[model samples]
Target: MAKPMRRLMNPALFICDLQEKFRPAIYEYPKVIATTQKMLKACKILNIPVFATTQNKSRLGETCEELGLDSPDGISTKVHADKTAFSMWTPEVRKAFADLPPTTPPTAKRECIIVGIESHICVTQTTLDLLREGHKVYVLADGVSSCNREEVPIALARLRAEGAVVTTSESWMYECMGDAGIQEFKEIAKLVKETKDSTQQSLQTLCKI
Candidate 1:
């Protein structure tokens, strides 16, 4: 008898409108950035491609420099775009998505992990659009926020209802890694340890009601 084929995950990171201008307005914005930084570091270790967007960069400013979206060694940025639309799923991003190598054996759908600002708007729309495109979406609870903290939970609940998996950054990282035996496990483990304090603080601040 033939053995069943192993499933594979082709995942990408989506950073939505975590720009400089909104840092002062978004609730717990620092915590959001901290969580996103952790994810970006993990993505670098795991070799996952990253796509980032800014909402009208002319007015909103660029994605926070601290995330290092432009640094080749910091994050594997496939497309860093500026958009007027609420969704990060713009034409440029779509084209970049199309250009990615197909999943091995072509059977697994891509998985998108999102982290960013204004959970009720850009993040929510991005999640919905990705779901519509037949991709599995995971929105990091600790990596998303809004001007009003109240909006965060509501947006998360709606996305969860809409089929997106609402999970924390650490949980999603492990889920993506899937095994301690993988080659990147040691590095990831170290990252988790190094960011322990910050992670806990971020969770408490960003996930609190």
Candidate 2:
């Protein structure tokens, strides 16, 4: 008898405007970077596609160097674009999504997980756009922040009400895998273990109301 195939969620990672220029302005910015690092590692292990954007490279510099979006062996991004639009859901990103090979079920929508800056603006708009297009959006509470920390919770609340899942990076990672019997489970579990301390600290700093 043949073994049944494991069911996996079709997911993508969106790193929105975690640029060099915004580092000092955003609240708990370091914590956000830490969480994004964890997710990027998990994505690499799980072979999930990544998409990244810069708010405006000319003025904002580029996505933080530490995330390693540009290195040959680092996070292999499907789309690393620069956009004037506050939302990361620009034409380039949309085209990339359209170009992805059809999902196993053909009709299954992609799940977009977001981690970035200015929670009330770019992140919020991105979530709304993804939701409008029928894709599931998970806005990581511990992976997003604004210059003003107070905007974080309010933005999350609005996104949640608007149909996005406001969750933590760790929670979304496990949920995306959905089954321990899958081949990547052990590696992912190890990643979760390795990131445990940073995850906890991020939650405490970035998730505060």
Identify the candidate with maximal lDDT.
Answer: 2
Question: What ranges in model 1 sit over 4 Å off?
Answer: 1-8
Tens-digit per-residue lDDT, 39-142, candidate 1: 98888887789999999999989888899887755665899999999999999999998899988549768989999978999999999999998999999999
lDDT of 2: 0.90
How close is each model in CA RMSD to the real structure?
Answer: 2.5, 1.4
Q: Per-residue lDDT tens digits of candidate 2, residues 1-209?
A: 44434455688999999998998899999999999999999999888899999988999898899999969878779999999999999999999988988886899999899999889999999999999999989999999999998999999999999999999988888787777877888999999999889999998888877
Per-candidate count of clashing residue pairs (backbone under 3 Å): 0, 0
Residue 4 C-alpha lDDT in model 1: 32
- Cα RMSD of predicted structure 2: 1.4
Off by over 4 Å in 2: 1-8
Clashing pairs for model 1 are: none
How much does candidate 2 score in TM-score? 0.96
State the C-alpha lDDT per candidate: 0.89, 0.90
